[model samples]
Target: MLIVSGWIAVDPEAREGYLAGCRRVVEEARATPGCLDFVLSADPLEADRITVYERWASDAELAGFRGSGPEPEQTAEIRDAQVHKYRISAIEPP
Candidate 1:
């Protein structure tokens, strides 16, 4: 499994539009095959900072979705963004 987490720093004035685009992208992403999870969240202390989290069944699945590129509206409003990926070796459910 693969995990992806990131934060996007958007223009303070453009935060709402960016979040709307993020929601649209997340909805589409969650419908794709092999998409385990996809979500976006706001940072409580930072009005312009948003956090993203994603889980995929495999690298191939992730690449397939990511190949489409970033959402235009979201990208336009973003001042900076960083995404980190991880490969899961094991999972334990409580």
Candidate 2:
């Protein structure tokens, strides 16, 4: 599996717009094939900061999503976003 973690900084005045865009992206992403999970969260300490967590079946699946440009509006709303993708061996037991 592939796991992705990221942070996005948004303008304070554009926070609502950013979140609306994010919701659209998340909905579309969740419907994509091989999308195991997709989540977005706001930083408790920083209202303008957003965090992302996602799991995909494989790197190829992720690449396919990226190639398809599924979330153009949301992608554009983010100020400075940094993402890290990792190959996951397992998920921690709950």
Candidate 3:
């Protein structure tokens, strides 16, 4: 499985809009073929911080979703928002 985590810092004034856009993206991504799980969370102590947790079947599938499709625009909007740190890793369950 492919797991990705990202930390996002949003503009204080644009938080609401950013979150609304993120919600739409998450919903659409969750419906995609290779998406096993998708989640967005806010940091309790940080008003402008947001985190994304995602699981996909493979890197190719995730790349395909990133390129073209109905959710691309919304995803791009979220990406264009603010600076973020992200990581992707392979996981094995015991």
Candidate 4:
């Protein structure tokens, strides 16, 4: 499985707009093949901070959905972001 996690700092004035866009993005991504999950949340400590977490069955599916660029609105509203991808080697349920 492939996992993706990230945090984005959005323009304070554009926070609501960015969150609206996030809803569309998450819905679309969740409908795509091999998408396990796509979640977006606002940070409690920072009003303009957004958190992202996603899971996919394979790299190909993730690439197909993400493409090579960020959405236009994303680039416009996001001031900064940090994203990381990882391959899950194991899972344990408590």
Best by lDDT: 4
User: Clashes in model 3: which pairs?
Assistant: none
lDDT of 4 by residue, 8-53 (tens): 8987667877788778788999999999999988888898888889
* Candidate 1 lDDT over residue span 43-94, tens digit each: 8889888888999999898999998688575567778889899999999997
TM-scores of the candidates in the order shown = 0.88, 0.81, 0.68, 0.90
lDDT (Cα) of model 4: 0.88
Q: Per-residue lDDT for 1-94 in model 3, tens only?
A: 6777776666555656767767877887899899988877776777767777788888887887767643554344443334332444544576
lDDT of each: 0.86, 0.81, 0.67, 0.88
Quick one: best TM-score, which candidate? 4
* Cα RMSD for candidates in order: 1.5, 2.2, 4.4, 1.3
Error of 1 at 87 (Å): 0.6
Error of 1 at 64 (Å): 1.0
lDDT rank order = 4, 1, 2, 3
Candidate 4 Cα outliers beyond 4 Å, as residue runs: none
Q: Supply the global lDDT for candidate 3.
A: 0.67
Candidate 4 global TM-score? 0.90
